[model samples]
Target: MKTNTYDLIIVGGGILGTFHAYHALKKGLSVLQLEKDNFPVGSTVRNFGQVVPSGMAGEWFDYGVRGLEIYQSIQQEMDISIRNNGSIYIASDTDEIQVIHELSAHYQTKGYDHALWSKAQILAKYPAMHADYVQEAIVFDQELSVEPETMIRQLHIFMQAKFEKYTLKYDTTVIACEDGNEQASLTTSNLEVFEGAKIIICNGYEFKILYRSLFDDSGLEISKLQMMRTKPLPQIQLPGNILTGLTIRRYESFEEYCPSFGTIPVPEHYHELRKYGIHILFKQATDGSIIVGDSHEYAAGNRLDDLGFAVDTYINDLMIAEANRIIPMRNDWITSSWSGFYAQHKDHMLEVDVSPRIHVRTGIGGKGMTASAGYAEQSIEKLF
Candidate 1:
């Protein structure tokens, strides 16, 4: 390799790309990371920051387990705002309660620790929770949370300070890529070229840049999600990740593990929830404000703009109303809201090598935050 060459060059600065760079650097491989923006503002920053392996299944769950270890390991080395607050799933009705109970048993069989909490215990811990809304609860105390807005930035800083083999470049868009017998090369918007022994493109959902036709035919779809946060309530306390009944019904782990799942009847009134793919979730930020979200709406990869950039007040109102049913959050107190987007393949993640040395690993969808750390480590090993 030449002076400007590296052992690995990672495209995209979100969690997927950064984690790949982290592992490459850990292996003593010289790494170069490029981000189109000054900083990451995609799903990595927009998510609820809940890292619950209990919400994942199979290999993804295994990846999330390792992700938790990776996150805690990073936090211990430096302050990256990692919290072991755990996650609690509040069951709002008998069907939901049964689903959680069965799911708990499934975990018990797997030797994963879990506790079934009575409504009394739920109320005692979450004082603000609606008494009638929670029929039962299941708690996983091993899960973690992070301050999404700062974790990546701080991780970048940590890498700069700790790893002499790492280089991070922001506001640099990769415009072209080529794979040669000896090295893989990419050219940025400035037409400057950098070479690497292997190149991995993890640009999240933005797929049209380097290999448009490949991604267009790769069965990728973009999902748009809505999010909101209430005004700071320094006096109130809602610790850990608060996942509600809708979440229990929707999270993949439940669908796969819970025998009662899909057997529960949806009342006519809840049709809209199913129509919009709404799953109410709450996570209190470090600033004492609660983060509320999210509803999913999708469009084909070629029609990313069809998902639209405008925030839907009706969706927010629906979320706020549903959130109020579970917790005492006042809609008028919600100070800020935004939309997040990510690309996903319905059956599996978008991972295939366009060339032997030039690899593509975008479109992991909602699994990115929970499993990216471990998945990227595994991906790096396979690529090299």
Candidate 2:
């Protein structure tokens, strides 16, 4: 019997929506999760897979900490491409060193595990990183690295077998949603209808089409980030997620926690790099290839087309130039490169209640992969 009914109907199967489903199922709610494609091919899969709560600040940091817990707990059950490799932020100079010291102080009161490693300690662990680039580093070993491309898919499989109430409908697009006081219903592209007590939307940058005007009126901006992957190099030994100097200056944690974050003036040479929002993060994949990159270009939610589908070679050039300064690498090693788009509010995540029953949550920005699991857990609690 095609009852076409569930306790909860979730639109979009990205990190945020999927986590929402995970928590809802924990409450024993019958869930129908709809995905526009065969599986998630958005920000959830397109990232450095750095689950570093150490890089987050304020409430989001709390969420990220909880996110780390959820990810590890899931790892205990299944092989989800998760590695407890830890995360490290290497200071390039004395100025960057000062901020990391203050960051350590901020976390000390919070009871998070962290350690400051000296130059020799850094060299002993990651020999591939240039010795000269190391001033000092703060290590968060509890942080994790996940293979983004496979994490969500494995998670879906894990959930299906564990929770019989969970139903995932991939390649199913919700084209229309009708609001109701008794029961809400949505129609898919195939003209099939689904009914549930509540509906939550977690589509990343594809923000509109469903409720176009609501998101456009909302203060949301989309950022297009460019990233690259290197060919497998068996000799290299770059462990964990390596966030360099630019990252130290850019992450929300440093800006909010470190007192000296604003005091140090970035040199003039960084102007061009900063203009494009360039930050270098490297993580070695299971294939032994190092993933490097990231440069940002932004536009308002309604103007997503302005940030086209094309990858800018110049931005990749700028990233590779910065990568050379951090590690010993040749241009030939960079085998593939691409771009990923994420949406964010300038101040925080864009959360709007379309109604008491319908919720729109997205614009999680760069923190989606790190914080969504925890954030969604809290959100589900509040909603229920």
Instruction: State which candidate has the highest lDDT.
Output: 2
TM-score for all models, in order of appearance: 0.98, 0.98
Off by over 4 Å in 1: 1-3
- Minimal lDDT window, size 10, model 1: 267-276
Residue 368 CA displacement from its true place in model 2, Å: 0.8
Model 2: pairs clashing at backbone N, Cα or C within 3 Å: none
lDDT over C-alpha atoms for residue 35 of model 2: 96
Model 2 residue 104 CA deviation (Å) reads 0.7
- Candidate 2 lDDT, tens digit per residue, 184-203? 88899888988899999997
Note the Cα lDDT for every prediction shown: 0.90, 0.91
Candidate 2 TM-score, C-alpha based: 0.98
